[model samples]
Target chain A: MAEQVLLLDFWPDPSGVRIRVALREKGVEYEYREEDFQNKSPLLLKMNPVHEQTPVLIHKGKPVSESLIIVQYIDEVWPHKSPLLPTDPYEQANARFWADYIDKKVHYFGRSVWETTGEAQESAKKELIHCFRTLKGELGDKTYFGGDRFGLVDVWLIPFYGWFYTLETFAANFSIAEECPKLVTWAQRCMERESVSKSLPDQHKLYDYILEHETGQNQPHL
Target chain B: MAEQVLLLDFWPDPSGVRIRVALREKGVEYEYREEDFQNKSPLLLKMNPVHEQTPVLIHKGKPVSESLIIVQYIDEVWPHKSPLLPTDPYEQANARFWADYIDKKVHYFGRSVWETTGEAQESAKKELIHCFRTLKGELGDKTYFGGDRFGLVDVWLIPFYGWFYTLETFAANFSIAEECPKLVTWAQRCMERESVSKSLPDQHKLYDYILEHETGQNQPHL
Candidate 1:
C-alpha cells in the first residue's frame, strides 16, 4: 500500500513551519493544504475538529493535530532517516522537557512581545530575553539542542527564529542577537540545512505579513 | 547499581497525583517527598529550576519535570508491565492529542471555576461543562480513554476528577455528573483501579484544602 500524507497549515505560522521542517527532514512526500482561519476548508475542519487549527498531519487518512505531536509522529513513522529523538528513555524525556519549555515559555512570551505595548510589552520583552538566555545556558557548547545532532529540541525551537524579524521590529529596543548571541549562532547553523532554510519563510517576509495583517493591540482587526 | 527513584510533590496537587498514579501503574517503588511551597526545599529547586513546580521524578539522580513528560518516561522505562501508551504511531499521536486537550482546556477552565465568582465563574462553569461534553463525545462507548486499557488519556484526566468537588462547590449551577454522565461513570470506573484510587486524593479533602488555602479572587492570600 502506498503512503498518503497531507499537512494543513497557514503560511508564516511558526507551529506549521515546525511540521514542515520535520517532514522535510524525514524526506516525507506530503500534500500541503493552506488553511484560511476565516473560511477554513472542510478538510481541515474534518481532520482537526477539536482545535480546527493549522499544522494537522493526515497520515493514511488519519489526522494528528498539535505541531509537537505531529513532529514526533513523523519521526516515529520515518525512523529509518534522521532520528529526531534520542533512543535512551532519560535523554528522550530531557529532550521533551526542553521542547515543552519552548512551547510554554518561549512561544508564549514571543506572542506577547509583538501583540502588546507599554509596560506589558516591556515585561514580555524581559521575559523573552530571559527565556532565550536560559535556552542558551541549556545549549552551552553544543552544536544543536540535542548535542551534535539536530534533533527534537532543535526542531521544536528553530522555527521561532523566523519570527525574530517581527519580534525585534515591533518590540522596542529588542534584539535577540544582543540578548543571546549563542542562540543566534545556533539558529544560523540550523538555517544552513536545506530542510530548515526551505521550511521557514523569510524573516523579513514574516515581518511584512504581520504588519500587513495589523496584528498588534492598537491596530484594527482586518 | 540499584535503581534510585524519588518523587517530590505537594499533597492534593492534581499534577503531582498524575506522576504518583503512573509510578504505581508501572509498579515502580520509589521514595516520595512532600514539598512545602512556603519554603521550598533546595532539592526541589535544584531538580526543577525551570518550573520549580511539584511532581519532579528523579530516577538514577536525573530529574524529569512536567507530569505528562514524567508519565511518558515511566511508561518507556517500565515497558515490561502495564503499557501506558499504544505501540502504533497513529494511536500514540491520537492519545497525545487528547492529553494535550485536557491540559489546555479542562485543567485551565477547571482552575477558573474555583478561582473566580459571579460572571467569570459562571462563564467558566459553562465552558467546563462544554469541555466535559466534548471529552464525552471523544470517549463515546470506550471502556477507557484508551479503550479496554486505562492509558495516557485516562491518566491525564482522572487526576482532574479529584478536583471535581471543589469545582462543583465553587461554580454556580455546575454539575459534571449531570452534564456529562458517561464521563462521570468513566471516572468511577477509573477509581476502581488501585493505582488511581490511591494516587488521587479524596475529593472532599481536596475541596477543604483549597478552602484552607483560600485560593480565590476575594480571599486574602495567607
Candidate 2:
C-alpha cells in the first residue's frame, strides 16, 4: 500500500516551517493543506482537536500534532535518509535537550520583544539576547548546534531567522548579528540548505506581514 | 570504573519526584542531594546554568537538566531495564505528545487553582478540570497511559498524584476520582508499583507542607 502523508500547515509559523524542513529532509511526499486562523478548517479542527492548531501531520489518516513531535515522528518512521537526531543515546538526549530549550525559552521571549513595549519589552529583549548568547556559547566552534551535523536544534531554531529582521527593525531596534555574531552566521549557514531555504519565508516578507497584521491592514494568519 | 550518579532534588517538587520515579524504574542507585531553594548549591547552579533548577541528574560528572529531558535520558541510558518509552515510532510520538501536553497544560492550570482567587481561580478550576477530563478520555479503559506498560506519560504524570489531596482539600474542592474515575483507578494501579510508590510523597504530608509553606510558617522547598 502507498503511504498517504498530509500536513496541515501555515506559511509563516516557525513551528510549521520546522515540520516542512523535516519532511523535506526525510524526502517525504506530503499534501500541504493551509489553515485559515480566522476560520480554522473543519479538517484541522478534527485532526488536532486538542490544540485546534495547524502543523498537524496526517499519516495514513492518523493525525500527529505538535511540530517537534511531528519532526521526530518523521525522523523515526523514515530513518534511512537525512537522519535528524543523533544515534548515540547521550548525544540524542543532548539534542533533545537543546531543542526543548529552544521550544520553551526562545519563542516566549522573542514574542515578548515584538509584542510589548516599555519595561516588559526591555526585559524581554534583555532575556532574549541572553538566550541567544547562551545558544552561541553552546554553538561555540561547532558547525551546527548538534556539532558537525545539521540536526534537531538547528532545524528547530533556524526558522526564527525569519523574524530577526522584524525584531531588529520594527520592535527592539537591537541587532542580533551585533549581539550574537556566531548564531547569525549559523542561521546563514542553515539558509543554504534547500530544505531550510524553501521552508522559511523571506525575512523582509515576514516583517511586512507582521507590520500588516499588527496594524490590522491584513487578515490574521497563524 | 564504577558509574557515579548524583541527583540534586527537592522533595514535594513534582518535577523532582518524576525524576526519582524514573531513576527507580531504571534501578540505578545514586546519591540524592536535596537543594536548599533559599541558597541553591553551587553544584546545582554549575550543573544547570541555564535554568538553575533541580531534578538535575549528574552521571559521570555531566549533568542533564529539565525533568522530562532527564527522564528521557534515564530511559535511554538504562535501556536494558524497565524501558520507559515505546519502541514503535508512532507510539513513541503519541506518548511524547501526551507527555508534552501534561507538561504544558496540567501544571500551569493546577498552580492557578491553588494560587489565585475569585474569577481567576474559578476559570483555572474549570480549565484544570477540562484538562483532567481530556486526559481521562485519552486513558479510556487502558491499564496505564501507554496501555498496559507503565511508561513515559505515566512516569511524568504520577508524581502529580502527590498533589491531589492538596488540590482537592485546599484548592479546587473538586474530586478527580469523581470527574475521572478511570484515571483515578489508573493512578491507583500506578501507585501499586514500588518505583512509583517510593518516589511519590504521601498526599496528606504534601497537603500539610503546602499549608505551612503558603502560610509562611515553614521553610520554602522547591
Candidate 3:
C-alpha cells in the first residue's frame, strides 16, 4: 500500500513549519491541506477534535496533533535520513527541552511584540531579546541549536526568523541581530537548508499581513 | 566510577512525583534533595539555570530539567526495565499529545479550582469537569491509560489524584470520582503500585496545606 501522509497546515504558523521541515528532511511525499483559520476545515476539526487546531499530520488515517509531536512521529516512522532528534536519550531530551522553550517563551513573546503597541510592545521586545539572548547563550557559537546538525531546534525556530523583519520594523525596539547576533547567525545558517528556506513563507508577505491586521485593513489574504 | 543520580524536588508537586515514580520504576538508587521553593537551593538554580524549576534530575553531574522531559529521559537512560513510553512512534506521539493536553488543559483547570474564588472558581470548576469528561472518554474501559500496562499518561496524571481530595473538599465545586469514575478506578489501580504510592504525599495533608495558605495562616511547610 502506498503511504498516505497528509498535513493540515496554515501558512503563517511556525508550528506547521516544524512538521513541514521534518517531512522534507525525511523526503516524505505527503499531501498538504491548507486550513482557513477563520473557518477551520471540518477535516482538521475532526482530525484534531481535542484542540480543533491545524498542523495535524495524518499518517495512514491516524492523526497526530501538536507540531513537535508530529515532527517526532515523522522522524521515528521514517528514520532513514535527516534525523530530527539525537539518537542518545540525553541529547534527545535536551533537544525536546529547547523546542518546548521556544514554544513557551519565544512563541508568546514573538506574538506579544506584534500584537501589542506602545509600552506593552516595548516590554515584549525586552522579553524577546532576553529570550533570544538566552537561546544564543545556549547556542554559543554552534552551527545550529543541536550543534553542527540542523535538527530539532533549527526546525522549530527557523520559521520565526521571517517574523524578525516585521518585529524589528513594526515594533522599532531593537534589531534581532543586534540583541542576539548569534541567534540571527544561527537562523541564517538554518536558512541554507532547502527544507528550512522553502517551508517558510516570504518574510515581507508575513510583514504585510501583520501590518494589515494592525492597521485594521481587511486581511482577505490572511 | 560509581553512578550518581540526584533529584531536586519539592513534595506535593505532581511534576516532581513523575520523576520520582519513573526513578522508582527503574529501581535506580539515588540521593534526593528537597528544594525550598521560597529559597531554592544554589544547586537547584545552578543545575536548571534555564527553568530554575525543580524535578531537575542530575545524572553524573549532567542536569535534565522539565518534569515530563526528565521523565522521558529517565525512561530512555534506563531502558532495561519499566519502559514508561511506548516504543512505537505513533503510540509515543499519542502519549505525548495527551501529556501535553494534561499540561495545557488539566494543569490549568486543576489549579484554578482551588486557586481562585467566587465566579472565577465557578468557571474553573465547569472547565475542570469538561476536561475530565474528555479524559474519561479517552480512558473508556482501559485498565490503564495505555491499556493493560501503566504508561506515560497514567504516570503524568495519577500525581494529580492526590490533589483531587483537596480540590473537592476545599473548592466544594465537585467530586472528581463522581464525575469520572473510570479515571478514579484507574487512579486506584495506580496507587496500588509501590512506585506511585511512595512518590505522592498524603492527600489530606496536602488539603490542609492548601487551606492554610488560602486562609492566610503561616505556611511553615510551604
Candidate 4:
C-alpha cells in the first residue's frame, strides 16, 4: 500500500513551515498544496471545516488539523525515522510545554510586527521580544530547544526564523540577532540541517512576498 | 521512594478536575492543595510564573501546567495504568485533534454562557451549541470519545459536565441535556467510574461555588 500524504499550506506561513519541516525530518514525501485564501481548495475546506485553515495534513484520507498536532502525528507515525519528541515522559512534557509556548505566545504575537504600525506594532514588537527573552532563558546553552536534538521546539521555532528578514525590513531598530543572539546562533545551526534549509522559503523572498500582497495578516474572517 | 505528587487547583475548576480524575484513575496517591486565588500560594507563583493558573501538577519538584498536557503527562509517566490516550499513532492523532478541539473550542467558549450577558452571552451560547454539535458529530454513538475506552476527549470534557448545573442555573432555558443529549448520556457513563465520581466536586456545590465566587472567568491575567 502506498502512503498518501498531502499538506495544505501557504508559503511563508510559520504553521505550514512547521509541518513541512516535520515531514522533511521524517523523510516523508507528500504533496504540498499552497492555499490561496481568496480561493481555498475544496479539499482544504472539507478537511478542516472547523478552522478552514492551511497546514492541514491529509494522511491516507484522514485529515489532521493544527500544525503542532500534525508535527506530533508525523513523528508518532514515523517513529522509526528521526524521532522528534524525547522518549522520557518528563522530557516529552517539557518539549510539549515549550512547543506550546512558541505557538501560543511567540507565533501568535510575532505576526503583529509586520501587520500593524505605530503603537500597535510597537506593543507587538515588545511582546515578541519578551516572548523570545523567555524562550531564550529556557533555551540557554542548549544546542537546540530540544537539548542535543533538533526536535519539536526547534521544529516549531526555526521556521519562524525564516521571517527574520521580513521583521527587520519592517522595523528599523528591531534585530533578532541583537535581542536573541543565542537563538540566532541556534537558528544558524538549524539551517545547517538539510530538512530545515530545504523546507524554509528564502527570507528575502518572503519579505517581497509579504510586501507585494500585504497578505501578511492572514487572520481568518470572523 | 514514595512518589511526591501535588495538584495546585481551585475548587469548581473544570480544568483542575481533569488532573484529579486522571490521578484517581491511576490510583496515584498525592496531596491536593486547594489554592486561595485571592492570595495565590508562593509555590504556585514560583512554579507557574508564566500563567500563575491552577491545575499545575507538581511531580517531585517539577511542575506541569495546562490540564490536557498534565493529563497526557500523567498517562505517559504512568503508562501501565488506565491510559488516557490511544497507543495507535493514527488513533493518537485523532485523540489529540479532538482533545485540542475540546480545549480550544469547547472549553474556551463553554463558560461564556454564564460570565457574559446580552448579545455576547447569546452568541456564546450559540457558539457553544455549535461546538457541541460538532463534537457530537464526531462522537456519534461511541461509548466514549475514544470509541470504547474512557480516553483523552472524555477526560478533557467530563469535568465541564460538572458545570452543566451551573450553566442551567444561570440561564432558565439553557439545558445541555436539550442541546447535547448524547453528551449528557456520555457524561452519565463517565460518572459511573469511581475515578470520575469521586474526583469531581458535587454539581450543586459547583453551582453554589460559582455563584459565590463569580470566578467564572479564569482568563490569564496579563
Candidate 5:
C-alpha cells in the first residue's frame, strides 16, 4: 500500500496554510499541488464537488475538504505525533472554541479590511484590533492558545499574522503588534516552531503578492 | 459524586435547541436555566466570557460553550445509548462539514430573512431558498442528514424548520416544503423521531410569538 497525502493549495492563503502546517507538524510526507483559483484542477473539483475550493486533502484514497475539518481528520488519522487537539474532552472543546472564534471573528475581519474602502476599511481595522486585543486578553500568560503547548488553535491563527502584519505595514495606518503586544508575541512564538516556520511564506513576499494582485481593484484597504 | 449538567439556554433559539436535542437523545438529565437574552444570566456570562452567549453547557461544573462543541462533548461522554457522530473518522468529518455548513449557510440565511427589507429581503429569500434547495439535493435519498440514524447534523438543523415555517407564514411568499420537497420531508422525518420531536417548540405557537414580537416593534420590513 502506498502512503499518500495530496494537498490542493495556494500560497499565502491562510486556509491552505492550515493543512500545510498540520502536515508538517505531523511530519507527514505529502505531495503539494498548487492550485490556480481561475483554473481549478480536475482533482480539486472531483474531490470537493460541493465547494470546489482549495486546501482539499486527499489522504490515502479518501478526500477531505474544508481546512478545519481536514486538520481534524489529519490529527485523528495520525495521532502518534504532534496531536492537534488535547486528550481531555473539555480541553479539546476549549481549543475548538478558540478555533471557531478565530474563524468567526478574525477570519472575516481580514477579508472585510481587504475588500472595503474608507470608513469600511477603518471599521474593519478597528474590528481586527478589537479581536486581537481580545485574543491577547484571552492568552493572559498562557504559552499557547492550547495552553502550555502549541496546538490546533495556535497553528490556525498564526498563519494570518503574516498577512495582517503586511496589511498594517502597507496601509501605514494600523499597528497590530503595538496595539495587541501579547498576540504579536504569541505569533512570533508560534513561528519559532519548525512546522510553522517552514510552512509560512515570507511576510514581504506575501505583501508584494497582495499588492500586485490587489492594485486597480476596488479592494478593501486592510 | 453528583452528576450535574448545567445548561444555560433560551427556549426559542435554534442553537440552544441543538444542545437540548443532544441531551434528550443521550438521555442525560440536565438542569436547564432559561436565559433572557435581553438580560443574560451571570452563569452564561462567566461561563462564556468571550461570546457571552447562551447554551453554555456546564458539565460537572466545567463550562462547554458553542452548541456543536457541546454536542460533540456530550456524544463522547455518553457514547453508548446514542451515537451523535459516527465512529469512523471520515464519516465524522463529513458530519461536521454539513453541521458547519448549516451553521454558516442555513442559520445566516434565516437571519437575513428576518432582519432585512425590500430588495435585501428578496436577496435574503433567494439565498435561503438556494441553501434549502442545496440541502434538499444533498439529502437526495438519505433517511436523515446522517443517513439511517438521526445524528448531530439533524439535531443542529431541525429547530430551523420551526423558524422556516414561521418565516413562510409571515412572508406568505415561500413554502420550504414546497420548494425543497426533500428537505421538507427530511424535517418531517426528523420531527417524527421522539428525541428531536420532543425538543422543538410547536410551529403555530412559535409563529404566534414571532407575530406578536413583530407587531410590538416598529421595525421596517425587509
Candidate 6:
C-alpha cells in the first residue's frame, strides 16, 4: 500500500494531539501540514466545510474531521501495530463512551472555565471539579483508562493533563490533582508512555502562552 | 441466541430517541423503562455512575451509556435487518462524524437557544440557523444523510425534527423549512418511515409539555 499523507490543521490542540499520539503509537508514516486559522489553507476549508475548524486530517486525499473520528479512522487504516481501540465490540463501545464522556463533559467544562469570569467561571470550575472527581472514581484501580493497556480513551485525554495543570496554576483557586489524586496518578502513568510523553508540550510553556495571549502580549495562535 | 432483554433507562430526551430510533429501525424488540431524574432508579445510577444520566441500555446484563454508543452497539449486535451504519470503514467513520456533529453542535446550540433570553436568545437563534443552513448544504440532492439510505446519522438526528415546528411556534423567530428547505425535506423523508413515525410523539404535545413545565405546572407529561 502507498503511504498516505496526513495533513493536520492543528495548533497545539489537545484534540489534535490524540491523532498524533495514535499515529505515533501505530508507527504510521505520513506527511504533516500545519494550518493557521486566521489564514486557513484552502484544503482545510474544502475538507471540513461545516465547522471550518482545526485538527482536520487529510488521509489519501479525503479529509476526516473531528479528532476522535480521525483517530478511529487512523486506527482502522493502520491496524498492524499498537491497536488504539479494543477488538471486542462491547469493550470498544465502553472505550468510546469514556472518550465521548471526556469530550462532552470534561472538555466543555474546561472551556467554560477558561472562557468566562466571576459567577460563570465559579460555576464552570465547580463542574470541572465534579467531572474530575467522577473520572478519578472510575480510574480507581486501573493503570490506564482502558484497563492495563493504553487505549483510545487514554490517548484522547492524556494531552489535557498538561492543560489541567496550567489551569490550576493560572486560576490559582483549584488544584485538579489535589482534588483527584487517582486521576493525577493515572495521568502520570499515561505520560510515562514514550508516545504520549514525546507528543505533549511543556505545561509551563502552555501556561505562559495562554497568559501572554490574554495579556495582549502575544497574538492569537489561530 | 436468546432474546436479549434490553433494559433502557430513558426519559423524554432527544438523545435517548437516537437509540430508540435505531432499535426500531433494526426491528429489534426491547423492553423500555423510563427513569426519573428527580428520583433516579438504582439500576440507572449503577449503570451510568459517572454521568448518572438517562438513555442507559442494559443488553444481556452489560450496560451501555451514551446515546450514540448505544446506537452503534445495537447496530453491531443485531446486523441481520436494516443496518444502521455502512460497512465500508471510510463510510462508517463519515456516518459517525455527522451523527456526532449533530449531537455536539446542533444539540448544544439548540440548548443555548432554549435556555437564553433577549440578546443571548437572538445570538443562539442565529447560530442555530447557521448550523441548519450548513446541514442543508451538506444534504443537498441526497435523500438521506447516508446518501441513498436512512442510516445512523439520519436516525440520530431525525427525532429533533419533531421539535422544529414547535420551536417555530413558541419562539416565533425562525422558520425551519423557509430557512433550510432541503433539511426540512430530508427530515420529512426520514419521518415518513414507519419506524421513525411510530417511535416519536406529536410535536404540539411536546411543546405544550415544555410550556407547562416552564410555567411551574410540573404535570406528569412535563
TM-score of chain B of each: 0.94, 0.93, 0.93, 0.91, 0.90, 0.90
CA RMSD for every model? 2.7, 2.5, 2.8, 2.6, 3.3, 3.6
DockQ preference between candidates 1 and 4, better one: 1
Which of candidates 1 and 5 reaches a greater lDDT?
1
| C-alpha lDDT (0 to 100) for residue A103 of candidate 3 | 88
lDDT of 1 by residue, A115-214 (tens): 7899999999999999999999999999999998899999989989998988988987888898899999999999999999999998898888777775
Error of 6 at B164 (Å): 2.6
Q: Per-residue lDDT of A1-222 in model 2, one digit per residue for the tens?
A: 157999888888999999999988888888888988888999988989998887899999999988888988999999999899998877887888889888888888887777788888889889989999989988999999878888999998998898898888855569899999899999999999999998998888888777778546345443
Give the CAPRI rating of model 6: medium
What proportion of the true contacts does each candidate reproduce? 0.94, 0.81, 0.97, 0.75, 0.81, 0.75
Clashing pairs in 5: A114-A220, A115-A220, A116-A220, B116-B222, B117-B222
Q: In terms of docking quality, how is candidate 3 classified?
A: high
Q: B86-155, model 5: which lDDT tens digit per residue?
A: 8789998988888888988888878777666688878888888988877777677989878888887888
Residue clash pairs of candidate 1: none
Q: i-RMS values of the candidates, in order?
A: 0.4, 1.0, 0.8, 0.9, 0.8, 1.0
lDDT, residue A125, model 2: 89
Residue B135 deviation, candidate 2, in Å? 1.4
Candidates 1 and 5 compared by TM-score, better number = 1
* Per-residue alpha-carbon lDDT of candidate 6 for residues A162-217, written as tens digits (9 for 90 to 100): 78866776465788867887888888888888888877878888777666664452
How well does each candidate superpose onto the true structure, as a TM-score?
Answer: 0.94, 0.94, 0.94, 0.92, 0.89, 0.86
DockQ of all models, two decimals each? 0.91, 0.78, 0.84, 0.77, 0.77, 0.69
**Alpha-carbon runs more than 4 Å astray in model 5:** A111-126, A171-174, A214-222, B114-127, B212-222
lDDT of 4 at B116: 81
lDDT per model vs. reference: 0.88, 0.85, 0.85, 0.84, 0.82, 0.78
- Model 2 misplaced regions, further than 4 Å: A214-222, B214-222
Q: Put down candidate 3 lDDT per residue, A1-222, tens digits, no spaces.
A: 258999998887788888888988888888998987768788988899998887899999999998888888888899888878999988999998998899899888988888888999999999988888888887887888877778898888888898899888878747888777778777887888888888989999889877776446333222
Q: Could you give candidate 2's per-residue lDDT for residues B97-174 as a string of tens digits?
A: 999899888888877777778798889878988988999998888888878888999997888777778778855468
